[model samples]
Target chain A: MDKTVNQKAWFLVLPVFLVVAFSAVLPLMTVVNYSMQDTFGNNQFFWNGVGWFKELLDPSTDLGGRFLASLGRNLFFSLVILAIEVPLGIVVALSMPRQGWTVAACLVILALPLLIPWNVVGTIWQIFGRPDIGLLGYVLNHIGIDYNYVSNEIDAWVTVIVMDVWHWTSLVALLCYAGLKSIPEAYYQAAQIDGASRWAVFKAIQLPKMNRVLLIAVLLRFMDSFMIYTEPFVVTGGGPGNSTTFVSIELVKIALGQFDLGKAAALSLVYNLIILIVCWIFYTVMTNASAERKPQEGAA
Target chain B: MARIDLVDLAHSYGGNDAPQDSFALKPVTMTWRQGGAYALLGPSGCGKTTLLNVISGIITPSRGKILFDGEDITPLSTQKRNIAQVFQFPVIYDTMTVGQNLAFPLKNRGVPKAEIDKRVAEIGRLLDLEPYLNRKATRLTADAKQKISLGRGLVRSDVAAVLFDEPLTVIDPELKWQLRSKLKALHRELDLTMIYVTHDQTEALTFADTVVVMHDGRVVQSGTPAELFDKPAHTFVGYFIGSPGMNIIPAEVRGREAKVGDHVIALNRSYDKLPDGAKIEIGVRPEFVEVVAPAPGLLSAKIERVDDLGRIRFARARLGDAKLAARAPAGFTSPDGTAGLKFDPSHVHVYADSLLVEGAA
Candidate 1:
């Protein structure tokens, strides 16, 4: 049978196409346009070709150095967050009551931090870490530990890291919790019958079962932490001489604060490229972890 | 291997002060002999799995003790009990190789490395899992995972008893048969005390030397397959054991005679006297009901429907208020709407209330 090709059928997707164009494609196209040009005040523009990109890529230049520093800061923060949160999340999720009214209450409480607006979370913690009036700050100072988030770079980094953890650790915990819940009761019972110890049970059953969800948690946390702006911006304002300025904060400061659209546009594109490349790497590793498995190898 | 004895065992998921009727497993005393293959057969919520859990020490019974060869072990955990159980769904360590999965139990007990490897290899070979020994458990098919689960149970020689709770439930139909036969063969070869729990009668009958039929959280009957078939002690057992089950019809019994709608039926054994308010019933299997030409001695039946099941034709007949199924042998003539049927005297059992009456066949 010969199949008839219908040209008019493409009209059915016109609405979705228009919606995507307006919502996504248009703004990205504007960014792409800005990325390729030099902008002056009063809407004046000059074609720069890849001049901005070249400047953004060079560590010798101030702009390139700042971008690299911000990139390193973002990567380091993400690593620290992951190192602290992943195991902590698993422990919390494991200790969580498997059933009963307590489960609902715990979930609602755990989800509370995630529900807070990012800027509001920052504001809340900014006051929370105040040396004079804040409970945490006052307590830390009274304990004879020098605590100040405003002037000290180390203090500022710690406060920002702690704030991000408080705000987002719930996400990791919840993902791990969902993963833990999905394991069947039979696994636990079988492990018991097999004389598996608590650690053995965790290693053999719980940990492997939580693998997929943990991957999801890591990816989500990595991406979100990489592009994080509002929370740290509101709380720390990239304080202590740019010690906590992640790439997104740097991009915002360059574009709007200094009105250097050309450099900012270049930085933004590079930042986006970094995110895409990192996410692709994560996606590749996770998918390969499953794909590299030999199909029915040694199976009868 | 140990002879597991449940001494007045009872369990209730509901907390203390719960009534007797609320107990998931009612107080019952039973023993599973050493090296015997027994099946706990019942419908869902009939306490089959509950009983299996109790035996494996997964659930501590609220009342009474569990004994293994005369040693009371009620306070012991499943690990302490040295019991191994294969669950309804295969439970395998997904990250481990099949060999590691099988060797887990032995390793946990601090068995020597050489011994663990030897046992793992032995079980792997027995279960036809030798080829998959090095494979990751997650990479195998559903049945292979189940085989690994079964292999884990068998790897430990010191296991007091290996319990199976509907272990074949997750396997595909074709694989279920093969795995079930393998389990039977393993039972014969190892002579381990294996107590299987299932709702399937065929699974119970084929895999076990003794089948314990349960209903409403109580053991209705425990006997060999042939005994349960020929003589179901309880009305529930009669209704539950066979394919179409036993035909139980309300009857009035007085001495050696039984009356159904004023039609007299001969009793093979004598009933000395009747108890007041006894709910008498005559139970007979469909296979034992003989269809004969319309005769004076036979009970008249109206053949409502004949279900042709290839070789044997099953005739569902209306005998007064009762629905009786009678199976015709191969190459037998199909009876018309009106046919006379005789309840095989030797196979017929008289029930008083729901319990089989003493000295009544």
Candidate 2:
């Protein structure tokens, strides 16, 4: 084999670099710039030099308290979403019809919520949770249960969680379904021949085969649920005394509603850093666990 | 551990009302004796896998019963029948260690811990898997994984029969022979009935004591390797079992003579009552016919080329517009175009409509 160093190959990467610089890097640099400066009226700016970061982290000031509370709410919501959706999604995927026209029908129905625009989903849920006009709220109230998302904090939280589950559990179910479908028929036959019970087969074959896809599902649900905004915003408006306010909603309120550019920029940067760190930890832990028993060349 | 019998077994995936030609497996009635090693050899889609699956109780035949040592097991589930099967590709639980994968079947059966450990150790030692006993099964190469699949099948001592469906297909070419011989040795030590299904003749001939050749959803022949070479029961068996397959040329027969296009040949015995208007043909292997100098009282053929295959040489010749192969002796020179061909009378067999014809003395 000939060993040659080709420097011209670097030219081929120029287009992607230019695209990323224009779309992602340049805007991110602007955010970074704003996070370190305090803006005055008429577009005048003064350097703050990490003062906003210190304030956001203090937890005693108003900006720090809001950031910490919203971050806590975001983490709790993500944990609850994972706990309910992952198992429910796997059960739905398992119970789905394996063959026939019913499979197509079920897939189409499962894909319905994912295709709707996010704001539209929020609007639909907002109207659907109104006790005066919506069926769900009207039925719950008529059945002797007090249910109103607009004026009650607990109800607002419940409405947001249930709405999120209804909207996104399908994604997890579809990913697990794809994982299940890729298993060959021979595995099932071999299991039957080995006298393995249904539960045994599930444990030994189906679950192991689904590990990679389940990791993807968990990461996606975690990140998406962490940064959720539109649906809860439309339904509760971070409302009933800020009970359902997640980190994205708080960031929007700080940056747009009060025009606190420096604080909002600092909060957004921290939020991005948290997500990146969490995802990295997730990927590293999972890959290391899967690779613990390393493969080597065989004697034969 | 038990003899298996297929009584009037037949299956048509299309349905019972489907025509005979549509049957995936035609009615097959054969007895596989206890502790006998058998190979089901055929080309792709010849129903070899279907037959093996039927015997293993994976597929319920549309008609007929499967018997295990005189007990009817036709309606039994694969687990209840106590059969084991290894598939073409390895099927191992990725999360389990090598030892755990081998012990899974026993554990599922609720075997005692002491017994499970004993059987797992026995199988591990047999397959040389003891070194990697604690490693995850998924971390091994494909051949090692296949060995794990085989180990799982062999771990259970009371299985009726162990069925292999081309288990060597995923193995490397060099490792195939080693694994194949290992399986043969296991059969010897265990004295268990094993049915190996493969499309490769080499694998079949080297592994089994008796090879059952199938064609077009029917078992064409069942015999030892020597028997299959000396006498093929059907034209397909003749054409399918050899490197350069048997030469089957059309001929006319009467009394003790067989007539090619222009040359008359003598038969060892009289095949006078060959089927009426049936297609008569002569079948002989390349090893039986010798290429010689053109001489009197011998059939003359045009020798096109001679192929030296390390151990033996074969001559491809044209006999009156029909192609045939004959052995070329060492230092045998080809004269301009024609050569004398001498066929051993006892080695030649007559066939009627692709089926062998038994001649009277």
List chain B TM-scores, each candidate: 0.95, 0.98
Name the candidate that leads on lDDT: 2
Candidate 2: tens digits of C-alpha lDDT, residues A126-145: 88888999988998999999
TM-score to true structure, per model: 0.95, 0.94
Candidate 2 residue A4 Cα shift, in angstroms, is 16
True contacts kept of 2: 0.67
lDDT of 2 at A115: 96
Worst lDDT run of 10 residues, candidate 1 chain B, spans B328-337
Quantify how close model 2 is to the true structure by its C-alpha RMSD in Å: 3.0
Query: On a 0 to 1 TM-score scale, where does candidate 2 land against the true structure?
Result: 0.94
Off by over 4 Å in 2: A1-22, A286-300
Candidate by candidate, in order, the iRMS in Å equals: 3.2, 3.3
C-alpha-based local distance difference test score of model 1 = 0.88
